[model samples]
Each structure stands twice: as C-alpha cells, then as structure tokens.
Target: MDYNEDTATDAVLASFEETTDPRLRAFLRLLVPHLHDLVFEFRPTLAEWEYAIEFLTRIGQKCDDTRQEFVLLSDVLGVSMLTETINGQQEGTESTVLGPFHMVASPQRKNGESIDLLGGARPCVIDATVLSTDGKPLVDAEVDVWQCTEDGFYDVQQPGIQPPGNGRGLFRTGEGGRFWFRTVVPSHYPIPQDGPVGELLKATGRHPYRPAHVHFIAKAEGHRALTTHLFVAGSPYIDSDAVFAVRKSLLTDFTESRDEDLARQYGVTVPFVLATPRIVIEPEEGDGSG
Candidate 1:
C-alpha cells in the first residue's frame, strides 16, 4: 500500500483492526481518521512538529506525585469537564472537575472537627448532609473534603508554609447523615502556572484562576461515589472559570454569622461564615439483589 496523505489514515487504522478489545478497536477506528485529518490539514513543518513533540514531552516531565500536568492540560482544554459531563450521574449533586490538587490523601477526622491546622483566618463552618435522592439519610457515608488555604494555596503547593492536611479532612456521616467541619474560608486561586500548562495558557492569553471552592468525594456502601465541588457564591471567576467548571447548581452561599452559640458548636470563633450544603447520592446500578 502506498503511504500518501490520502492513504495514511486507512493504512494506520488497518493496523489496529485486529485489536482484541472491542472498545479499543472501535475507538482507534474512530480516532485515526480525525487525527489524520487534522495532521493533513495543518501540514506542519518538521521543525513545528518537533516543537509540538517537545511541548508534550515537557508536559510529561513536569508531572510528579503531587502534581498532574496531563490532567491540568486536559482541564485547561475543557476536556476534563466535557468527559465528566458525559459520564456523570444523572441525579443528585452536579459534578465538576476533581482538579489536579487531589493527589494527597485526606486524613480522617471526627465530625465537628476542624481541618484548619494553621488557624488565625476568618473561620467557616461546613454543615453538610448526605442523603439519598428520596431523602433517606445515608449513614456511615464517607465525605472527603479539601480546599486551598485562605491565601489561595493548597498544603501540597506550599510545602514548608502549610502543614500537611491543613485544609483536608475525611469525615463519616453520623446520625441523620450529617457531617460538619471547621476551616477558614477558601480563597480563589490559580492553578499551578509554573509548568508546560502554564506556558500554554500564557501563550493563549488564558487565565489560570479557579474560584474559591471546597472539593468533596462522597461515598457510601450501596451508592455511587460522587466527586464534586461547592463553589463559594460571588467568588471571582465564577462566571468565567479558567477551567469552565462552574455549575450554577453547585454555587453555594457562604453566609456570615455573628452567633457565638453556633460558632462554639463548630469550634470556631464568632463573626464566622457558614456553608450548609446538602449532598444527594444515587444508588449504583444493580445496587441490591443479584
């Protein structure tokens, strides 16, 4: 077979025609033509192709145990959100990107405990509940939460400054499917912009900021695990999120309260903020009965 632009795609796809996995074979068959079409249309010079390769190489090299450059790339390109939207749960809380900062494990803490290790910032209480779509409480549910510091950096992002688990906690829902935690209000922050993804954003005139939000991964024995964000209402970039992840349903108000009694209940001082969000979980497919 002659290897010309017109024949190249079919020839390459033919090589993968024998892929054992049905899904992989179908994906390759669908992907090759479009990829080849782009290559043919762009007609990059050898130097430009080399640069593209180098760019991807740097993206891989920038990844570490704490940072995921590929996910960051996918996020900035809106690919992550698109994929999530396509395969997300139909009922319950709306889903969003998990972001690149969830690389570390959350330390388990008791209900009503505080995840704010540094303290000294304006505190906020998160009173959350996990329930089934039918409003039944999901007992023993695990809710993993994490967020950036008041200064807009995760503990992993500022190693020496922020203590480990400074803004992270894993709590189990108690009676009535309730869990609460104390932490400082999170500030809007930029995604890591010191690597290849940053360079791409700069070149494209795109910002790297995400709005203030706390990430949650809620799971139970029979329910489908949910990964979502609770965006602070009125936060910067809510409308023009850098990663296009802001969903109106997930925007939650952080109300100010000077009630000393409520503050003491959550172990925070007065003049604090309160965020009360309810999470609904859907049962996994084939949840019961064989």
Candidate 2:
C-alpha cells in the first residue's frame, strides 16, 4: 500500500475499514470514492481544500439552539429541497421543504384565533380543511401553522420585537375537518445572509429571498402527515425560491371580500381578505414504508 497522489483516495478510504457501524461504513465507502474523484477532477490545491474545510467548520460553528447553520448551508446548496423531492410521496399531495424557521414548538390555540400576538394591522383569515384525496373529510386532524410577520420576519428571528409565539399556532380540526385562524399576511423576505452560506450565494450571484407563505403541518390518525406551504399568489421570489420549495399546486390566493356575514363568523372586520384552502391528506399503507 504505497500511498501517493494517485493512492491518496484509497489510503483515506481504507482508514475507515475499522468502523464498526455497518451503515457508517457503507456511507463512508461510497462517499470516499466520489469525493476522491471530485478532488482529482478539480485538482484543487492544498490551500483551496483547507479553505473549503474551514468554511464548512464555520457553518457548523454558527449553529445554536435557535439557528441551524447546517440546514441553512443545505438550503443554500439546494440539497434540502432535492432530498425532499427524492423522498416525495407520488400519490399524496406535493411536499415541500420544512424551512429553518420551524425550530420551535407552536402553542395550541383555539380555532379562528389570531396568531399575531403583536396585533399589528396586517390581519387576514385562513380557512382550511383536511380532506382525503377521495374527497372525504378527515375529522380530528391537527394543523400546526407558523409564519413570518407582515414585514417579513419570523417570531424567532425577532425575539425582542415580537413576543414568543407571535406568529405561530396549532389548531385541531372541528366537525367536517375544518379549521381557521387569523394572522397577518406575511411578506416575502430574504433568508439569513450573514454566514458562509450567504457568502456562497453572493459568490454565485444568487438571491436569498423566499416567497410569502404560511407553513402547514397536518396530521391525522391513519394518514401520513403533510408538510407544505400555501404560497401567496404574485409574491416575490415565488419563481426563484432560495430553497426551491415552490410548487404550482401549493400556490393560493389571498382573496379580498366584502361579505359581512363571513367576517362576523371569523370574528374579523368586514371587507377583509380570506385565504380558503383545502389540504388533501393521503392515507398511509401498511407499515408506512417510505
């Protein structure tokens, strides 16, 4: 085993032969060959490799309890959405990436209650239903929702300005699998651009903005839970989502209405905007494989 430039890959790979975990061994075995090819193809200098490793190290070091740097790195690299797309459910509704903002537990709230604890003026009503693909209602389903403010900042992103849980809520479906809530219409905003991921975006001439949307995580007893977003129509970055999460089926309209009766029912002012969406959950087969 004479290790040289040509044998560097093999030497590094053989070092992992002593790994006990079968999965880890298999992963390393596959990763080493491809990584070696990449290095050989690029022929990057030692300084270049060192710089890349340091960049990755900094990405990890930037993470903490509230922020996830690795996820941000994956997002900027489009790896998160690609992974989600690969494991996506075909027969079920389309799935999207669970963005980094969903790090905290959403507080349980009554139906039609406003998640905007700050009580700023960007109010709107969201009405949705949990239904099977066969058009049957899924009673007792749980819909967990969170979103950014009208000004494009999440509650966690602005802990001091916004109270905890200012823009998050968990709601249980009532009879007929219906649920509703009140919240400010979130505006489009850029993802965090202060880390290595941001630098990568800048180097590649890519913008870090995400379109306006309300996050939804819906679940029922016999059906697989769905993680998706109802993206606002005509929002910026809808065509160029930094994470590639926008799906045409998930685009929803925030329609304006002057119906006083409907407003009274949802406890909102007349002539308010409403977003009516029907979330279709697919039933899980035996053992829930994949």
Candidate 3:
C-alpha cells in the first residue's frame, strides 16, 4: 500500500466509501480524484502550500452576516453562473447569480410602491408580470427585488448612509399577475474589492465590475420559483461582466420616458426610465396545473 500519486487519490476516496449519504459519497469520490490530480500535476513548495492555506483562511475570515466571501469567490470564478445554468428552469427567464446582497429579507411593499428611500436620483419604473410557461397569469405571486443605488452601492454595502431596505422590496402580483415598483436606475459598480477575492482579482489583473442590473426572485404557489436578473442594456460592463452572469435574453432596455401622465401613474416625476420585464415560471410537480 505504498502511497504514490495515483494511489493517493484512491486511498482517500476509499475512506469515504462508507459515507451514509449516497450523494455525499459520490461527490467525495469525484472530488478527491480531481483534487489529488491537481495536486499531483502541480507540486508546490511548502511555502506555496502555506500561502494557499492562508489565502483560503482569509477568505473565510472575510465572511460575515452581511458579506459572503465564498459566494463572491464562486461568482468571480464563474462557478455561480455555471451552477445556475445547470439547475435553471428550462422554459423561463434565464437565471443569474443571486449576489451576496440578498442576505437580508426584503421589506414588503405595495404594488407600484417605490423602493428608493433617498429620493432625487433618476427614477426607473419596473413593470413586471409573473406568468406560467403556458402564459397563464399567476395571481398573488411574490416578487422580491433589489438593486444598487444610483451611486452604485447596495443598502447593505453602505449601512450608515442607506437606510435598511433602501433598494429592496417584496411585492405581490396584483390582478393579471402584474407588479410595478419605482426605483432609481441602478448604476454599474465594482464588486466588493476589500477582501481575499479582491486580492485574487488584482493578482490576476481582472476587474471586479459588474453590469447594472436588478435582481428578482419570483415565486408562486404552484409554480417553480425563478431567481434571475434584468440587466440594463447598453450598460457599462454588460459585455464584460466580471461575474460572467449575463445572458443576452436578460438584457433589457430601460427606455427613457418623459410622459407626465405615465410619471403621475407610477407616482414619479417626468423623465424616468421605464422597464417592462416578464417572468415565466413552470408548474411544480403534482401541482395539478401542468
């Protein structure tokens, strides 16, 4: 039982063969070989291994109630987007990363209400509909939405300056599965670059900017929930999103509208951007709506 590069992985994997959970056993069986293969392929100096351990340690230390360094790590590495792609609904709006900012609960608000607490920024009205894949409107669907401010910082990112839920809302679809809300057009901003992930990005000469987008998590009683984004079309970094979460279908135009009547309807001043995004959910199994 001499430990060699090829046998090392097998020995470690065999140790997990007795795991009770089949999924866990399978994952370990697969992960161990690949990880060992990586180690075997690129043998590192003791100092390098120590530095790697310290890097991962710092990544864990950087996480908190409000910030998730692991999610950021997955995002910057494109793992989050890949996971979403693999598990996403087949016939709905394309899924994207549920960025770290969704750590808090969204405050419930009425339809057409404004999520923006600090006013005076340019307004954008989001008129959205939640429907089944068959085009049937889903009544009373919950839509949780959040975005950064016009200054490109989320409420959580600037706790002292931005009130809680400054750019977040939980609304339900009204009749015809419609929901609308008012908020400032979010600005393209860099991801938090104050931690290990930031250091990694800098070491790799990669930028940390993501395109302007609004996140949505739509759920209905009998339908599969959808977590996705409405990316601002033509926004900076749209084509080069640092997280690699952009899908062409999710890119939407926030058209400029100066209609006073439309402004009054949404309770916003004139010259606001109007966005209309439709979300489609699939019926869950055994829901009897299929």
Error of 1 at 128 (Å): 0.4
In TM-score terms, candidate 1 sits at: 0.97
User: Which ranges of candidate 2 are over 4 A from the true structure?
Assistant: 17-22, 287-290
lDDT of 3 by residue, 1-290 (tens): 88886578878988888899989988898899888878878998899999999999999999999999999999999999999999898787878889889999999999988999999468889999999989999889999999999989999999899999999999999999999998999999999999999999999999999999999999998788889999999999998899999999999989999999999988888889999989999889777754
lDDT of 1 by residue, 35-110 (tens): 8888889999999999999999999999998989999999999999999898788888988899999999999999
Residue-level lDDT tens digits of model 2 in 1-290: 78888789889888999999999999999999898889879989999999999999999998987788799888877898888888666665677888898999999999979999888674699988988767889888999999999899998888789998888999999989999998878999999888888899999999989999999999998888888889999898899998889999989999887899988988888668799899988878774533
Candidate 1 residue-pair clash tally? 0
Q: lDDT scores for all predictions?
A: 0.91, 0.88, 0.92
Q: Listing every candidate in turn, what is its Cα RMSD in Å to the true structure after a full C-alpha superposition?
A: 1.5, 2.0, 1.2
Cα deviation at 225, candidate 1, in Å, is 0.6
> Clashes per prediction?
0, 0, 0
Candidate 1 stretches greater than 4 Å from native = 288-290
Ranking by lDDT: 3, 1, 2
Indicate the residue-level lDDT of 40 in model 1.
85
For model 3, the stretches where C-alpha displacement exceeds 4 angstroms are: 287-290
User: Hey, what RMSD does candidate 3 come out at?
Assistant: 1.2
